[model samples]
Target chain A: MKTIGLYKYLPIEHKESLLDLETDRPIPTRKDLLVEVKAISINPVDVKVRSPKENVEPSPKILGWDASGTVVEVGEDCKLFKLGDEVFYSGSITRQGTYSEYHLVDERIVGHKPKRITHAEAAALPLTTITAWEALFERLRINSDDVEGNKEKTILIIGGAGGVGSIAIQLAKWAGLNVVATASREESVAWVRKLGADEVINHYQSFTEQLTNLQIQEVDYILCLNHTEQHWESMGDVIRPQGKICSIVETEEPLNLNVLKNKSVTFVWEFMFTRSMYQTEDMIEQHLLLNNVSGLIDKGVLRSTMNQKLSPINASNLKKAHALVETGRTIGKVVLESF
Target chain B: MKTIGLYKYLPIEHKESLLDLETDRPIPTRKDLLVEVKAISINPVDVKVRSPKENVEPSPKILGWDASGTVVEVGEDCKLFKLGDEVFYSGSITRQGTYSEYHLVDERIVGHKPKRITHAEAAALPLTTITAWEALFERLRINSDDVEGNKEKTILIIGGAGGVGSIAIQLAKWAGLNVVATASREESVAWVRKLGADEVINHYQSFTEQLTNLQIQEVDYILCLNHTEQHWESMGDVIRPQGKICSIVETEEPLNLNVLKNKSVTFVWEFMFTRSMYQTEDMIEQHLLLNNVSGLIDKGVLRSTMNQKLSPINASNLKKAHALVETGRTIGKVVLESF
Candidate 1:
């Protein structure tokens, strides 16, 4: 099998930052599906993993998470997926990734791909969709059933033009929340509004001031996809008393949690890999959420966030995708398809 | 009217720390009840309010929260209680407190005092019970409807012998969680066990090791009634992935929130005053919870934690109670009764 991987962490522009390597195809085990990777999407995690680090790998570290593929073989214990099934998944973070020609994923976290979407488009949806879904519905505890109850609620999504934020804006709108999204550039601002943001604010400015100018007092929820530390105090200032806030961005500094004490606000971190990392009993929830997202996408209630695509899954194209994501300004998702 | 209050923050031993003062009787307004206080309880909040500081108040600041009293007058808009009805409440933190002979409280946060309990016992309950109930059921999102489901879950109550922790142990037991409480002293351990903690561990030791010794791995919920910063790392370690943690104690320093990222754990602050402070639409939930707590006490499902009492609420007795709580080692609660 041919794969794209890193033997040592280096600048993406450096020669051999990513390499074309030959590896033996892995066999399916209990609850595993041997998937033939058809399309792969690049995320900021890929850039972070590929950045310069002190340790060199003994074996090449394949790094990719989002994929749309076909199941080539299924383990005997697998109950959900069958051979030749078209599937999409944001594979586990601790295991080998989807950059290989063939990959293995637990059947419980894989979902049937949206029938109406192309492989590239489907590949772009899984990771961001899972992140957005879990951050809003699970971590923030947004009530999806009560549309009337949600109509009065508001959510502020920082970095709203990014992959997860694009989907998050839509999901929050679907849950009937008034969506206030932050995007610095005009294009990004227009992008979030197109994705259903009720209002757009500048992330570089004071969030409270922007909200005040919009005649909004405070937000009921805040989903921070950008810098957590930089926005922490502003989030504390703007979140309603007893309101909830969730962030996916990791902070470099410790947070003064006492800022939220007087308001009795909640702060939750939503790392989408938590279930898979811990092998939690509810790991199957990922499969369920992906299926729900697929249904919504097929039903035209949601759309894929595939903003850019490259041909032929190879080291060069993967490196290009990584470089684009490293810029930290990619609007949605950048995908690669076909070997 | 006679009241005990402080014009300046001072050492607890100072004779004028809490002063006896005479003031005009306050009249009831819309939704207000002019209650003749029969008993008032000292909580940690009283100590915090009286702790030495440089600022001096223009007028003396009354500092008591838990009170049991008879409504002497009801405003036209007050529908929950009539004149002469005995009620107990942990009133709003923003309002003038319950240290005065006549106290004015909003009717909505008040509940009918348990008929079976004495006024001192009822006073001991309101502040601690409201804190415990909201921390467990609201902040932690414990499902009270499914006792069978709850029986499979576990909760760790830190500082199990404190006022809030005592009531929390009982409430968690009522909600069917396997309750593991942390208490250092033998008497405090016995107290929590008597309040229905299934097991007791010392908060000074490693919580994970203690839980492991007891054949438990991790808890589904954690109610932190003591220092959050001190136990934060251990709490993160012993919390199940996707578990909930609620705390009434505010952290004095910044917290390393990134530790809970991989587990996607929730951290919520439970200030019982949140609803009243914000004048939230759901403020009546306090009334409902207190009424439910009253029923539980009357039915003998929950016991009052009034461990000490002093007659005729006065400056001296109130100061004494405040001094005890300032030591940060008081067990259960201390109540000062009728003037």
Candidate 2:
């Protein structure tokens, strides 16, 4: 099986950062599905995990998470999926990732791929979609079923053109919220607007001022996909009293949590890997949500977020995708198809 | 009308820290209810707000909040209460407080007094009950209506013997959650146990070790009533993945919020004053929940947490109650009754 593996974490510019290797195809065990990788997407988590580090792996370390693949085999305990099922998943951080021709994932965290989209497009959806879904519905506790109740509610999606933000804008809109998205660049702004953002505000400007200009006093919720530290105070300023803020970005320093105290705001971290990493009792929620998202996609309520696609999944193509994502300005998602 | 007013922020020992002032009775308007104060309770907020500082008020500044009284007058717009109606409430922080012979409050935040308890007992409830109920069912999103669903959930309440924790323990228990409360003193431990805490742990010790010893690996929710900065990390350590943590205590410094990121944990502030302070659309929720609490108390499902009571609400009695609460060791609530 052809795989993209690394011996040591290095900058993307380095030739040795990612290498093509022939690794033995892994087998399925206890609720695991042996997925033959079809397409993969690059996310910030992939870059962060593969960032330059001093530690070296004794063996090849596979380094991808988002994948759209076919389940070639299933373990004895697997009930959600079967052999030949086309699946999509953001594989667990603790397990061997999906930067290989074949990967193993727990069936509880995998979803059947949206039949309406191509594999490359499907690959772009899993990681970001799962994150946006959980951050909106689970972490922030938005009642997605109550469209009438959500009509009066508004959500601000920070970094709206990024992978997660792109999907979050759509999901928030789908949930019947007044969606205000932040995008600084012209292309990014247009992209988010196209993705169903009712209002677009620049992330570089004062969120309060921008929202006020748009006749929004404060947002009912905020989904932060950019630097949590940089937007911490701005988010605090614009969130309504008793509102919720969910962030996927990891901050470099401690946060001044006191800023939100008077408003009694809720601050939640929405790491998509949390369920798989902890093996929580509700880990299967990811599977369920993903299936729901797939159904939404099939119904034409959501479009694939894949903005750029590279063919023949290889180290070079992944490195190229990594470098593009590293610029931190890529709109939507960058995917690689057909290893 | 006789009121306990302060001209300067001073230590509790100061002679003029609180003074009895003869003031004209206030009239009700715009959903306002003019209540003849019968009883009042001293909470940590009162002590904190009255803490020593250089600021001086040109006029006497009143400082108490929790009150049980009779509505002497009601504004034309006030439909929630009428003249002679007995009520209990924690008035908005933005308004002059409740340490007067006659106090004015918005009828939307006032609740019918529990028929089973005396004015002194009811006075001990409003501030703490509102804080606990909001922290549990609202901020933590625990469904008190879903007792069967809550049976599998567990909550660890820090500082179980304090004003808010006492009520939180009972409310969490009523919600059918397994409640673990923290107390260091033997008397405090016994008090929380009597309040229906399923288990009692010492906050001075490690929560992880204590819960593990009790065969509990982690809790689904944490209600923090003590110092948030001190328990932030420990609260993160024992919280189950995707768990919610609600804190009433303020932090002295920035918090390392990253500690909870891996678990996708929720950190929410449960400021009892948020709704009323912000004049939010849901400000009336306090009135609704307080009425629910009153019914619960009348039904014997909940009880007043008043422990010690002082007679003839005067400056001297208030000073003593403030001094006792400032000690940070007062179990239950210190209340003063009858002006």
Task: Give candidate 2's error at residue A187 in angstroms.
Answer: 1.0
TM-score for each candidate, following the candidate numbering: 0.99, 0.99
lDDT of 2 by residue, A1-339 (tens): 999999999999999999999999988889999999999999988898899999999999998889999999999899998779999999899988899999999999999999999999999999999999999999898999999999999999999999999899899888999999999989999999999999999999899898889999999999999899999999999999999999998898988998999999999999999999999889999999999999999999999999999999999999999999999999999999997
Q: Write down the lDDT of every candidate, Cα atoms only.
A: 0.93, 0.93
Instruction: After the best TM-score superposition of candidate 1, give how far the Cα of residue B207 lies from its true spot, in angstroms.
Output: 0.9
Colliding residue pairs in candidate 1: none
Q: Which 10 successive residues of model 1 chain B have the least lDDT summed?
A: B318-327
- List, residue by residue over B130-225, the lDDT tens digit for candidate 1: 889989888898987778899999999999999999999999889889999999998998889888999999999999899999999999999998
* Backbone clashes under 3 angstroms, per model: 0, 0
The fnat score for candidate 2 comes to 0.94
Roughly what TM-score does model 1 have, to 2 decimal places?
A: 0.99
Q: Measured with DockQ on alpha carbons, how good is candidate 2?
A: 0.90
